[model samples]
Target: MNRLQKLTALDTRFFYWCNDLHRDLGLAPVSRFVSRLGDGVLYLLVGLGFALWEREQGVIFLQVGLMAFALELPLYLILKNTIRRDRPCDRLSGFRAVIKPSDKFSFPSGHAAAAFLFATIMSAFYPPLAPFVFILAGLIGLSRVLLGVHYPSDIAAGALLGVCSAVVALHLWELI
Candidate 1:
């Protein structure tokens, strides 16, 4: 098999194991709740709340949220269109995905990206909360894999991208 095929094959097995573990741990409800909280509306409200509570922190939240979307959305769109990786649910031999994926492509998970981006941004603002946010993000990322909606590599890349985006945004904010 080619490199990409090998990668996907590995991911398929990894995700299957994760799915089993999640099922064993009874993570369905928790995953669903976390996923719901990851939506744009909740993120906006949370950022606004932070902004209201602490003006400077609120600004950082707004900036980070905007920057994350600015970086992630376009990349998701482009890669989804270009890579067009099929969702595991669609494949007959693939793991039976718990969640219904909207699109066919499943290269880099938007959920994973958003989770890490928010965690990274929030950590920057409140260093004390770094561990909590990262742990949350890590759980969110694993949820995607557990649900069979994303490969482990997909989450990893998304996280890396998120970290890069957050760093860039912070540097840019510092300049302005």
Candidate 2:
């Protein structure tokens, strides 16, 4: 197999490994909660709450986070469509997804990207929350794999894309 093929093989192997590890009686609820947090609702509430409590910092947080999301959306879509990778649940026979994805293609995970983007921006403004935010973001990525919708590489790429988008947003905010 070529290098790309080898990497793809590795990704599939890692997905199964994670899936096997995910088999548990109690982890389902935890995974569900973590994944839901990455869905943007929690972030929206936190942003709005922060804005109400502290106007200046909250405005910065929302601005940076929303900018990152806006930048990530189209970029993620382009990559997903360009790569046109099938979800593990779709590609692997008998593999089932715990939740239906918003779209068919799955190369880079939008949830993971958005989670990390929000985490990165939130960390920049509130350094103390960095550990918790990143931990949750990491869990979000892992949950995608455990839920059988994404490969390990997809999570990794989404995380990288998210952090990079956050950085770009911060830079843009500084310029303005």
Candidate 3:
């Protein structure tokens, strides 16, 4: 088989393994909570809070966040539409996701992308929170898989996209 095909096969197996563990551990409730955190509301609030209440650094963070999301969202939409990959829930036979996905296609999961994007921004603005935010971002990605809506590779792609977006935003903000 070709390399892409082999990768898909392995990804499917890994997905199943994660789903199995999720089922065995009864982690659906926790997964749902974690996944929901990546839905954008919290990020917006945090950014706004920083901009309104915090000092100059907070304002800078909010600005950088806005720039990052502006970049990430467009890129995410283009990639999702271009790739048009089916989610595990849609593609797998006799398997359904624990939660309904926000969008139709799933490649480079938006949740993972948003989570990591915020994580990267937060880390850049407040280096002290790097470990916590990154860990939480990772959990958000893991929650997508545990809930059976995304493959690990999707999360990885999203992570790369997010980190890159944030990096670009940071550089742009520096120029301002």
TM-scores for every predicted model: 0.88, 0.95, 0.98
Show pairs that collide, candidate 2: none
Q: 53, model 3: CA deviation in Å?
A: 3.0
Model 3 root mean square deviation, Cα atoms? 0.8
> Model 1, which residues run further than 4 Å from truth?
1-5, 92-94
Q: Indicate whether candidate 1 or candidate 3 has the larger lDDT.
A: 3
1-176: candidate 1 lDDT, tens digit per residue: 89979977788788778788898998888887776666557667778889889898787778777876798778777877887777777764835777787788887777777778888888888889899889988887777777777788888877877777777787777887
lDDT by residue (69-97, candidate 3, tens digit) is: 99999999999999999999999999999
Alpha carbon deviation, residue 16, candidate 2 (Å): 0.3
Can you list the residue pairs that collide in candidate 3?
none
Between candidates 2 and 3, the one scoring higher on TM-score is 3
What is the lDDT for 128 in model 2? 98
Clash pairs (backbone) in predicted model 1: 51-58
Worst 10 residues of 3 by lDDT: 50-59
